[model samples]
Target: MTEDLMLLQEKVTLLRSEGKYKETIEACQHLLEWGMAANDHKSVLVAHLHKIASYYCIGDIEEAFNNIGTYIELCSIYGDELDKLNLNNILFLLYEFNKDFNKAKATLEVSIALGKKLNKYIIISNGYSNYSHIYCAEENYEDALKMAKEGLDTAKLLEPASPILELRVKLNMAKAYIGLENFEASKSLIDEMINDPILDSFIREKSNCYDLQGNWYSKQTLYREAFESYTVAKNLVESYNDVYLLKAIQAERCKLCDLMNDVQLGYLVQKEYIAILNQISNRELELVALRLNIKHSITDIEKKANTDYLTGLFNRKYIEYTANQWLEQASITNDNIVCIAFDIDNFKSINDTYGHLFGDEVIQHVSKSFSKKFGEHDLVGRYGGDEFIIILKNISLSDGKIKAEQIEESFKSIEMMKNGLSISITASIGVSDNSGGSVVTFTDLFQKADVELYKAKLLGKNQISCGS
Candidate 1:
């Protein structure tokens, strides 16, 4: 059974290496079931840990947390001090990911205490390293520097010093110094790591060094030097096809562009950032669905998160968030902003005449049509049971009214079939614009459009009304 488990573990590794994250998780699940049935506590723990890694690789934070919960439970029941220490470290990372800084700090303290009690230098060093990173993230450069130095000192006292561990501490120290505006010290540390022959084999570390150098240069207003360093880091990560590193580099580049006041370049970089984020999000959703044995795909989860489940259009929460952001931007740029609110002409009657499911089909069809009619930058969301909202940027009132008319026409042309009967769909739309306003809020715009929509309904449905 142990040999079988080892073989299964190998298969999981191979699948993960091949980017088959779903298959890797499925194999881990099978191994876990076998371990439980065979009463193989060690194998069960290992399987759970493996599943956690696979879930993290696929960026499924929630699923990773679930597996970590099980792993921690098993560790308490059947693990050694070392296992407990490692589990605490994992818990620290999970809490950190959720931005629960207090919990992460507590977990790190537990790891440090256990490592000291067990006389484990590696664990002690790693705990300090992680603690330093947390401080750096929170902008506590002095504390970060102290923790990093402590970690390095502890690492140096190991019977056989670990160069990789030492290098990691050095990197943390460099970052802390960078945060402190001590460019010379930061440069010295980064240069030391780059000059070390032992570190040459670690491409990711090399890339990180360049990225830090880029950050330091950017902070000093050396835009050209920063760009060069960022390019080097990007090229190194690109050679390894490290998507996460690539994403980080792109984000840095975006910030640099913004700092340089290159709005066009910043916009391009922002688009790339969104694209990468979406990819990561989709991959995470896929791993989560697989772990839960759900039949839906990543796209399905994404759709359900941001869109109305029944109509397959953006949900109210998403639209509100995005629309607020656009409104803020419009205020800064003096851009025209328009809001449209619309609902089915006789939605309640349709639901009463046909079944609710048939009514749902009508909503779905109309939502799809609205999605097709809008620009990529436009925002459309299901505001309520039978109502939808759209926010258009940099469009005039006349153009918005034209769009509203087009929407009404397109939706009215749709045919809904139920019980061998055909029904024509029509909608009433209310449009509002913030073209000449000093300041406009989402609530104000929504209310204005909604009032106009009421007027349209009162004047007879399947018509458009405009408001200033």
Candidate 2:
């Protein structure tokens, strides 16, 4: 029965990963039934937790809250201190998401008490970090910074440093530093985060690091550097599918654009930012409707409406939104911003010869490969059919050329298999940066890059061209 339950759990995980949220909930229900029948309290708790996660993923927050209640009740009857502590943390997040800051703070207090009772340094450290986040959210920068320092101090007592917990603490501390207008300290923290190997796989944390750096630059009146930082943060959030962070970053970009006197771009980004907020609001409404057992009509639009369907990259509208923000930032700071435009060489012939499906495979393969060659902060988007554009922030013209060459080389090594036949793909890249005296708006920079791209194609497909 244990082995069967384990298999069922795996199935639930797989379903969730595949975005089959309804199926995942159904599987969890099946597991719950089995666990209850067998008198296995732990299994029952696990099943309920899984169901809660699935409901949350599906944006059915009311269902998640109900399951969380059930989980908490079960914990009361059969859980240890650690279990209760963990459940309280989850409750804290749910309340935070719902904007119930008072309740969230109360729950965090309970978690801290539980951790103290358990005498677990890690839990205590996590509690401090979460407390710092709350304070930071409330704009109490000094208190937040102090809490983060306490969290770090607690974490230092662990035999081996808890990288995940430490990272969280550092992130909160960085944000606090930004809030206090300590730009240099905030930048140092972000630089440390970027160089930390443990944070490499934690895309959100790394993204936050860049976001904080952007905020620092913004505070210092270095609008161009701030724009570059924000662009990188936005790209990372998009890549990670973090809608909440994306909305926040977009909002910041809108403000920055307005400050730069680019009212048109500001309005466009503001529109997108409001749309994301509405989506979040609708999710909250769904949660309320669920609690009342009332049916709510949810729009069936794709979650990433701004992204290209095939490559999962930003579509033209979002690219315009980000590019406009970057260009405005560059104009003010006189900082360097580069645009790289590229397309698959002979893409039409490949589509004609190998069929559209294989051509799509090539596009996906190249998109993945090209995206990997750049940092998480750099913006990469599918401009149109075969064309892709990248915004390289804070990079010199010489470096942009070197990076373009590297991308071209990377594309040359891509092999896509169809019908057991191996197909090699290549791309022509054009590089242009704001370092060129005449480049002004994003459109101008992109046009310059496009000209270089045309040169690359004319000089023989698979090569790179750079604009002076």
Candidate 3:
């Protein structure tokens, strides 16, 4: 089985290397299924990572974003600290590519925080470089230069050193300098980049240097030189068949065309540019439809996971999770937090007197009636077969009692003919509040409400009992 998984992974790698992105995605799906069946979480995580890469390579950033959630979940469980740092780095770059600069910065912060914790100076340095890149994207040149300076200093702390990484940082710093109109400083860096043997080894980097040269020339009113520089960059990008770089180079040409006011030149290049841009737009639109479908599927899965099968209300586990969050947040505000518990009166008798199916109808009917009386902010959950719990925030205890009483009354008034079976129901209610820390946690508050519910049952079946 392990051998089979390894061979499958190799196939995925080969397919991706061949630019068979769609096949690669399909193979990754099988890999996930196989790994999950064997409980091999590491392989599962690897599959998710590869799938994300495939999606990103195909320019499906939305799918990449969706898959990141599950990857983070698996990574947290099975991946190491270095794995986490890499995840942060990948997430930062992913967000950056998606043009979500704020989220990119946020992910970089996570990378930096983890790097600091692990004393991994390389991660910190790369993190600073990413910050510079993000700032440059936002046209915040001063901050970009600051981050680039920091990246440079941090790179020095690396024991062995990464010349390539340092080179990339310098490129970013140079771009920042260009943005700030420091043409001389930019020219110095650009000249160094053009002369560097390392850039010779990297076609994309070399192309980018030429692109920057065009920018420098254009900004200095050197249109003829800028046009030549852009041509060189475009030819290099075309040689590499880099869609992203080609698009950027073409955009620069578009601006140049307008500035030069050369109608013939503009028409000659812009047809291809428009075609590529339209391809991207069409691809994005198709993905938008796919994204909506995926989103619906995800929502259905979440609903099944979190809601009770019988009544379509949140189950015990989800309620516990959500209630705990509310309890944690309650300290931020002194607003009254109420926990209401209730059980259908004589539920066992109802099930025995009628059929269990009819009893189900009763439960569903009561749930609908009970939930509809409360606002969306109220948390409603089926705590047990016949019991329900709700949490309401920013409401007075007296208001909570009134709401509970209303729900009890609502159950008394509703009749349901589910599957041609008729039933009427009422519930005994209990109410408790953390107005002054009478209960400190969700469990404590729910138990207090349960006690009040017991009192309501002792006094009479269909009634509300408030904590006294």
In candidate 3, residue 462 scores what lDDT? 83
Candidate 1 ranges with C-alpha deviation above 4 Å: 2-20, 255-468
| TM-score of every prediction relative to native | 0.56, 0.55, 0.63
For each predicted model, how many residue pairs clash, with residues at least 3 apart or on different chains? 0, 1, 0
Please give, for residues 1-468, the per-residue lDDT of candidate 2 as tens digits: 988887887887788788776667767777776776577887787777767776776666776797797798899999877677768877887888887878988988888788778778888888889888989889999999998999899888888767877888899999998899887788888888878997678888888888888888888888778877998898888886677888889878988997788888778778878887888788778656653432221111222545889998877766776777887877788778889999998999989988998888888888888888887688888998889999988889889998888888787678787678877788889998876434567788888899999999999888899987
Largest TM-score belongs to which candidate?
A: 3
What ranking emerges by TM-score with the best candidate at the front?
3, 1, 2
lDDT of 1 by residue, 237-296 (tens): 877767677888888888788778889878887897788788777766765666565224
RMSD of model 2, in Å? 28.2
- lDDT, each prediction: 0.83, 0.81, 0.83
Off by over 4 Å in 3: 1-121, 124-163, 173-203, 213-229, 235-247, 254-264, 280-302, 325-333, 349-355, 394-399, 414-426, 435-437, 459-464
Pairs in clash, predicted candidate 2: 232-377
**Candidate 2, run of 10 with poorest lDDT:** 294-303
Better-scoring candidate (lDDT), 2 or 3: 3
lDDT of 3 by residue, 61-97 (tens): 8788788898998888899887677677768768888
